[model samples]
Target: MDYVSALLPPVVMAAFFIALVVTIVKSQGGANKAKEDAAVDAALSRAESARQSQP
Candidate 1:
C-alpha cells in the first residue's frame, strides 16, 4: 500500500530515535560520571592557563 509504505519509514525512524535517546539518558551520571567530569575540568583548566599565558 502506498500509505503504509509512506508511513513505515517515519515509524522506523521514530523508533530508532527513541532508542538512541534512551541509551544516552541511561548512560549519564553512572560509573563514568567522575571520569567525565574530571576530563572536562582538566580541559577547562588547560584552556584557562593557555589564555592567561597569551596576555
Candidate 2:
C-alpha cells in the first residue's frame, strides 16, 4: 500500500484539475460579457451623475 498512498494525493489533484479545465472549456461567453458590460455601464452612469452633482 506504500505506492498507492504515495500516489493518491497527486491522482486526486490531477482529477480535480482536469474537471476544472473541462468546466472552463464548456462554459458560455455571451452572458458573462453582458454581465461585465452592465457592470461597467452602471459604474459609468454613477460617475456621470456624481460629476453633474459637483459644482
Candidate 3:
C-alpha cells in the first residue's frame, strides 16, 4: 500500500503529460496551418521592415 501510494502520483502525472503532448501534436498543421503560417510571416515581415528603417 505504501509503494502504491508513492507511485500513484507519478503515474497520474505521466498520464496527463502524455495527453498534453498528444493534444499539441495533433493540433499542428491542420486547418489552422495556413493561418498560423501567415501570422508568422506577417510578424517576420514587420520586424524586417522595422529593422531596415532603423539604420
| Model 1 score (lDDT) | 0.97
The per-prediction tally of clashing pairs is: 0, 0, 0
Question: For candidate 1, what's the RMSD?
Answer: 0.9
TM-score of each: 0.89, 0.55, 0.83
Residue 53 local lDDT, model 1: 98
Top candidate by TM-score: 1
| Candidate 2: tens digits of C-alpha lDDT, residues 1-55 | 9999999999999999999998887664666878878899999999999999999
Ten contiguous residues with the weakest lDDT in model 3: 46-55
> Can you tell me which runs of candidate 2 are displaced by over 4 Å?
30-55
Full candidate order by lDDT, most accurate first: 3, 1, 2
TM-score of candidate 2 against the unseen true structure:
0.55
Show where candidate 1 strays beyond 4 Å.
none
Minimal lDDT window, size 10, model 1: 46-55
**Which ten residues in a row are the worst by lDDT in model 2?**
25-34
Pairs that clash in candidate 1? none
